[model samples]
Target: MSTLARWLLALFGWKVIYVPPPAPKAVLIFYPHTSNWDFFIGILTRSVVRLPARYAAKDTLFRWPFGWIFAKLGGVPVNRRERTGLVNQLAEEFKRHESFYLVITPEGTRRATSSIKSGFYRLTMLAGVPLGCAFIDYSRREIGVLGYLNLTGNQAEDLTNIVKLYAGRRGKHPTQEGRLVFAAESARSGD
Candidate 1:
């Protein structure tokens, strides 16, 4: 699998800068998710790095004949309609596991958005896990973890540091890249 991933990535002029996760249990953020291609690129990178990470998706995506395929690929069903205590439930799941990497795309969409959703940040903080800053830079044809941050409960300062890690990184569609600011940040500041 690793060899295949390497060949596929290098065949397309992409390079993987393997930065191991800071902890066995973590919440990884992959930013600048502006294209459908990001999923394939992420899968390739995951295989190359041998990252045993699971991604969350809508509950409906986990049904039918193809559901097993998604499960095989590390998909965790998320009931977006009923998010009450979801974070805590996931946190408990994390505690039950010896190694778990919950990969989240905080932007939560492919279109340009003014602010990010706060679920990733909240889950990371509540779960007491490092937030791994994973990135895909179209400008550099690179994909890897930049670093891990143990976020302070202060959302603003913590978010500022996360944003800085992504400096100079470009998404496949640079114009559609989502901003790092969360809506909660604005609400707190009365913006």
Candidate 2:
């Protein structure tokens, strides 16, 4: 574990309660990403679990000194505003790399929203990889990996089952709501 990650663990008193499947290729999904602290807890969880997971962030944040640090910490910068397709770009990245664990937030933001972006499902489908669930429960100061969800191109059914698995999990971020909220809403909207 990196020093920053160790410091975070000490500061937050985080503990991983679940161990995910040992998959070579997978997309890890995180919920209720409503604050910057979500990333902090995520870093600690990843380090404690000893997983070589990578996450995407806005391109602008990868500047100079900070960029160097992010790269060392396994950050993949994505151009969110680019007119080019995102799924294709991520698919290509996945194809280029022999093994990688990409982390994505289904909610896509910290604020309360009624729906989840389909990029996570689309990325896994295009890359032909499974989905892993990473969750943080602030109420319990617990962070866990909820195994893997093998995608079968049936977005509605697959997501429903996945969300049901994490039905009562709470969000670590303050502004964002619980995972159940987004999961239930996603199921209702069929997104």
Candidate 3:
């Protein structure tokens, strides 16, 4: 799978930059998720780098037969309807796993938005893990894991830094890319 993924990415003129060393637990959040194609690129990159990562998807996709396959591919079912306590559940998963890398799209959707969902930040903080910032720079045809940022438990400051890190990075649809902003409650809560 690694070899095939590498070949396909090379054939398509796409490249992956730094892949960090394996960590016991980390939240890998990618920015500029403006296209559905990002999921395919992310899957291939996961294979190419052989990273042990799990991604959250809507729980509806986990119904019947396909659920097993998705789970095998490290897909975690997220029940968006019951939004509360998801971060705590994910944190528990991290605690149980000796090594876990959870992939997240802070934007929560492909559509344009002004702010990122604070779930990723809250999850990492609860799980006591660093947040890994990955980027898909469409302009450069590159997908790279820029490594992890250790959160200081200050939501506003941490989110601000994360947004700054993604500055200058381009998404496939520039106009649809979300700006990373957090809610005022998140900024004040410090939780």
lDDT of each: 0.87, 0.76, 0.85
Q: What lDDT does candidate 1 reach at residue 162? A: 92
Best by TM-score: 1
Q: What tens digits encode model 3's per-residue C-alpha lDDT throughout 1-191?
A: 99999999899989998758446789989898999898889889888888878899878778897788778888988877765689988999999988888898887878887667889988988898889998899899999797678999987788778878888889999999876777655455553
Task: Report the C-alpha lDDT of model 1 over 1-191, residue by residue, as the tens digit.
Answer: 98998899999999888679778999999988999888788888999999899987667778997788778889888887765777888888888999999888888888888788888988898889999999999999999889999999998899989989999999999999888998966567665
What's the TM-score of every candidate structure? 0.92, 0.83, 0.90
Rank candidates by lDDT, best first. Answer: 1, 3, 2
Instruction: Give the Cα-based TM-score of candidate 1 against the true structure.
Output: 0.92
Model 1: colliding residue pairs: none
Model 3: clashing residue pairs?
A: none
Number of the candidate with higher TM-score, 2 or 3:
3
Residue 100 C-alpha lDDT in model 1: 93
Off by over 4 Å in 2: 2-11, 173-175, 178-191
